[model samples]
Target: MNAFNEISKSTAAFFVQAGASFGVSFLGAIGGIYFLPLDPWQRLFLGMTVLFLVASSFTLAKVIRDQQEASTIRVRLDEARMEKLLAEHNPFSAA
Candidate 1:
């Protein structure tokens, strides 16, 4: 079907884009390391430090996102409880 062909094309395009982005980023990192004036050991240390920082940042972001989601869920639950209480208190309600 035409839709299937379109889906396949889009998937291929996504793969190509991802590959290109990775290649560019890899080259840029290599170039940056090569240009640094630090000794080999220092460069290695710095690279490792940068990687650790990046990993930590990703972890921190996930934690923050999870906390936000939990707070949102709590808020919704509170709102639902309040609504139920209000309905129960309404004198005009046909119990």
Candidate 2:
């Protein structure tokens, strides 16, 4: 119900999906390598495989980084807000 919980749930979902996609792509790449003939056309498949692998890796990194950043921001923001509320309510603090 809270912002932090919501963010965590969505971020977890994204990571799961990203991981699944990466796995599928990896399997497909392996299959493609084996099915492609070793002719000039094979170069095309090789290029595509390389590009797919690179792009998938980049995508995975970006998703992980983004989720990490989001989680960090949520934690810091919650901490700041709690600190502010605590400061406001504390009877021991000097005026």
Candidate 3:
């Protein structure tokens, strides 16, 4: 386990693949909206909704990661305190 950051980092290839996938999916959604037989107003609305969904998804991901990191830090602190307490005590020693 890494002392600095308990969580492992994603690989560069994973990042590249994720970026490419996001780009392709976003473009595909926009293209689909463009080629739809619906009215221009409807297409525009759908595109705006999709954009909002993407933004919200990113926000949610950030919040979840932050919460996870906070919990991990809390657990690490608790563990350190427990270790210190244990190190200071000995059953064989007279009180």
Candidate 3 lDDT by residue in tens digits, 25-49 = 9999999999999998999999999
By TM-score rank, best first, the candidates go 3, 1, 2
Model 1 lDDT at residue 27: 69
Any runs in candidate 2 off by more than 4 Å, and if so which? 1-37, 91-95
| Best of the candidates, TM-score | 3
The C-alpha stretches of model 3 lying farther than 4 A from their native spots are 1-7
Clashing pairs in 1: none
1-95 per-residue lDDT for model 2 (tens digits):
67655765657688899889978977787677767767867767786877877889799989998999888889999999999998879687788
Global fold similarity of model 1 (TM-score): 0.62
* Model 3 superposed RMSD (Cα): 1.9
Q: What is the C-alpha lDDT of each candidate?
A: 0.77, 0.80, 0.93
TM-score of each: 0.62, 0.55, 0.88
Candidate 2 local Cα displacement, residue 1, angstroms? 33
lDDT of model 3 at position 77: 94
Give me the displacement of residue 27 in model 2, in angstroms: 22
Decide which is better by lDDT, 2 or 3: 3
